[model samples]
Target: MPLHRIPVTADLIRGALDLETTPDGGLVPHRLPPRARARNTDPQLAAVEVQPSGVRLAFRTRATEVELEVRPTTRVYAAAPPRPPALYDLLVDGTLTAQSAATGGDTLTVDMTTGATELTPGPPGTVRFTGLPARLKDVEIWLPYAQKTELRALRTDAPVEPAAASGRKRWLHHGSSISHGTDAASPTAVWPAVAASLGGVDLLNLGFGGSAMLDPFTARAIRDTPADLITLKVGINIVNADAMRMRAFGPAVHGFLDTIRDGHPDTPILLISPIHCPIHETTPGPGALDLPAFAAGTLRFLATGDPGEAAKGRLTLVTIREALERIVTQRAAEGDKLAYLNGLDLYGPDDKDLPLPDDLHPDTATHRRMGERFAERVWGRDGSLEGF
Candidate 1:
């Protein structure tokens, strides 16, 4: 069959804030805009921002066979058991019709103990979807959120073009690794993706792994982006990193919301607290990975900060939740369009049946549950986000 090469362009991409040109003429999708990325210099932030968590190639095509050339860079812990290569999800007309994982690509190994890195380069590979519906329909191929994937090319037996707008509400969400879909079964299985599917909204996920620090640049990116509804999942990373004290946390939250409000004054914004994390629920943190556990081939994390530190206003999940409640209530009384959701409503002590696998991120089933609950609360009839 003859294949038509479709140029990898921004017009055909979704969930990426900017598309940077690669050295090999490919395109690298960025979650953060150019100006924002320039000011920040954290290697972790730079790494996750380019991983394409919610990014995808979206178009309308009648192609029975579709192929995407990808240079996928997979991350591995140097001394830990290898993780499965991330999967690519192909959705046809809003349903998950197919899925594929990269067959060959580069590998980036990091020493969890020392934070050193080594790269083993490998050849590029293809993710193909065959026997797609022959009739013209919407096609979305979700990128591997777990890997750094560069789009080399898109080829199909049938022609492809930018998809017509579906008129769905645009939902912008920013959170930490949990929101970034770390342990999600596949790209589209992330909670936000599932929630977007159920809510009938287009998702622009700003969920970066280990990087949602309430930074002003991130807030500005959200500020400039257009969205009908917005949600901020805070507290987990703050507590895990023990990044700040309660006094600083409140103002940081306010400033983050304030920056977004500058661009979306009337947009419905939901400020969500950290979900139930028993380790950090009462205990404060600077979460530390259990190195011995990892060396023993079992991954685990422990909160290092003392619970007694709360008396000194050191942050914890419980402390942040209370502060968020008061903050949102105060803002609402002042006529702000902000609402609050306890992340526990999405996952809590009752969810012990689906415990976070690594003691940090949610598993596939939990992601599904959270997504469903989020949709019901925000998109269901009489949903808090309904009127907006």
Candidate 2:
């Protein structure tokens, strides 16, 4: 049977706030809005913002075989360990059915010591998924989390149309690399995506890697997006960057939440503190890549700031957790529909079997574990999000 090409339009896209038209007329999904992108100056944040953490192509089709032509640009550090290619996940009727990857496209090489970047242009490749069920069903092709992808074309054996909305509550989430899917197994394996699936909710993930720094623009973007539920995972990134001291941290958190509340005054907001990170539990950050480990083709992290800095108002995971609890408590008194969750409940100290390989980010298995725990706690019966 001859395959018919379908124009990948905005109606078939989900979870992206903006769709940037590529030079080739392809579409690049952006988790951030145009105004938010315009406001950002940090290159790190800019790169991660277009990573398409929870972005996917959604439609209804009876196709048994489908092909998606995408220009996937994967980044690699010169003189560092070679990274594996990110995966594309296909879901039929809300269940994961197949996983594959586009082998070659563009390669972005970064000079680690110097902040230099080189993009070696390459051809766009197609990711093909076959053996899908014959009956008409909802189909979703989840783009890789960290890889920058520009979708060019979609081809299928059978015709496709806009998928019916699930009528589920939209869960808007913002967090650090863990939620951005630093080392997740696949796109759908990202903790936020996983939890969204289990909870039967739509996800709008603004989990930028090393970029969830409590910026005003991020808060404004969240405030502007319509969502039935919201979650803010704070602390780890602040500790990682050693971005602020106690004097600024408190006000910053308040300001971030305040902006989100401006648009969603009564939306149930869950503020989650940092999970178990031994390096930053009591120590201040300015964390550095473990050079020796990196040289040996292994990635690890080490905190450089002094533990005593906490006395001088330097924030740590320990201190941040206490502050978050207090903030939620104070807000609740004012009749804010707010709740607090110690992120440790999602991935705590006791889960020694599932280790965070880098001393920072969770591994793929840990990501799934965290998602399962999150679903049980926040979406289960008598849960924080259940009755609210």
Candidate 3:
């Protein structure tokens, strides 16, 4: 069988380039590259740095004979950049397609026509790239880069389509860095991506590295977006960032879910807690650690242990487990359209001995394992994803 190929051209570059700036002045390209370009040009540059923001790209094409190619995906390529940071997710048509970590790269493709394209990163330094479509009338790119990187130039050769849509249901996931695939080797290798591929479902990954702290804005974002199956990997960020405590965590989660339910009333919403992090798992409250950095070496984050403040409530693994159990119990009784998956079930104490090196994120193999487990335990037998 011959593989289908989409063509490429230069006319796809007009307003299709978007850029975001980080706290430290640096550029991040969000859109995909054009199919072809003039012999010499800067490839229609869009630069960005640190603080999170949005970039847009729109295209109009009249060449029926032309196909498009967007290449060399760009986004936050490093995890720690010598400063506090924020992560971002790239969205196309209100659906999250890719996310960038302090150290991650994702490429998103979209059809032509101006719509809402958003880029939201965690903090400090992160980058996001939006890839060009295989065919287009006009193209637009959005960049949200918060650090530094050498974006040699946008290059494209051919169209790349992993699979064709076949009326299958879609799986949408929103989580912290783990779901954003912090340590995964490639976009396709991320656990969510892997699970989506295996389950034969379309994917809308809203994972935003350190940004999944049960924020109302994020929950509203998820609510506004449409999906057949939805999963939110919560806990890690709330704990790591020390965003809330037990007293507030419960209401916040309820509120977050309430907002999401407003839009996806019938969709299955799976709430996943934090994966195993030995350092903080047993700790009583807010804490941070200096682990091997994502960039060349080691990095340190603010580690504070304050039991007398709001930060204390946000810390602790026990708090997470309690809050999750409360939500699950409350919702399950009413038969509300929501479910819960324990983080330990995904990565438990039995798996803790395995070395992560980074101390925060899992590696590729673990990602694969996690994806398989998610499919087998959550998606395979569940009727919710049967149509997908």
Candidate 4:
């Protein structure tokens, strides 16, 4: 039998697989099975692609890429079964196309007008994206939210190019709903994304909505991930979930940091207190709504009175402040490379005076303001958040 070889071109590659370029010149895999979809219910899937050097994924246009040198050993492990209705708009050769949905299993397939093609299959542990466009200079994967996804490994068929000599810094942040951006209109609008854009640094957002409970697993996850600068937003979720009190809060913070420091000995670790929420601001968490009424849409969870007054002696704001203060002071005394930022500085009592209809999450405007405040306080010139 004679051997036949087909020259690979962008058009040919485009014809074979269901993929598209994003507005920011990145490739997005679409028509994937439901499980691998981006979690946001919003009809958008960020771009995912391959570059000569490696793969690049972005959440914001100005977001930084966690480049992995593609080798045979390169394997990226992102949280699968991404929030669904996977939809992405791509910009290929200046042309726009919509790609949708991603499925996961032994085989991952993407659909295009051309046909359905295999994206991942064969080896139980290995997934390959082949037949790429030749003009590919860079590849990017945009996430739907400002949350961190682990890239366990990365490898390519050929040796990857040397690292770029860019002067930009990388910032890794971990937080709860505020940082995860529960209500942001788009991924790019998230606080961490906005801050990363303003600061001109790469970001690894470990912000997980309803998931930042100062858990050891999460802390270990943060420590395991690589970063140049790190920040952890604590207290809000703990208070909201009523996960812990003064007694447990301090030790949890310490243990969390201790785990991270073990992996990143000298990395700058910032501890961020919770942003202002009128309901939980002065109250202890585990607050409940009338489930039945809430479901019926007849009830509203508005913070009518001073939350502090309501919480009085139970789970007061003063208690959270004291707990965080003690943790920072103790860590500082031990010469640990940790820094603490008061949530009030970001959004305090004064801000709380404003009405929050939802009483829990902040509106988009508030999110923007919070991001700006964080940038100013932590990344400002001559800021105390230096050399962490």
- Candidate lDDT scores, in order, read 0.91, 0.91, 0.53, 0.51
Arrange candidates by lDDT, descending.
2, 1, 3, 4
Off by over 4 Å in 3: 1-164, 284-296, 299-303, 306-314, 381-388
Model 1 scores what on Cα lDDT? 0.91
TM-score, one value per model = 0.97, 0.97, 0.60, 0.59
Task: Give the alpha carbon lDDT tens digit for every residue of 367-387 in model 1.
Answer: 999999988888875444663
TM-score of 1: 0.97
RMSD of each: 1.3, 1.3, 12.4, 12.5
| Residue-level lDDT tens digits of model 3 in 262-319 | 9988888788888877666756435454443323455434335543443445467756
Writing each residue's lDDT as its tens digit, candidate 4 over 128-189 gives 33333444333333333422122223333332232233356767787776776665654555
Error of 2 at 12 (Å): 0.4
* Worst-scoring 10-residue span by lDDT in model 3: 43-52
> Which ten contiguous residues of candidate 2 have the minimum total lDDT?
379-388
lDDT of 1 at 326: 97
Show the lowest summed lDDT stretch of 10 residues, model 1.
Answer: 379-388
Among these predictions, the greatest lDDT belongs to 2
- The list of candidate 4 runs beyond 4 A from truth reads 1-141, 146-167, 290-314, 352-357, 382-388
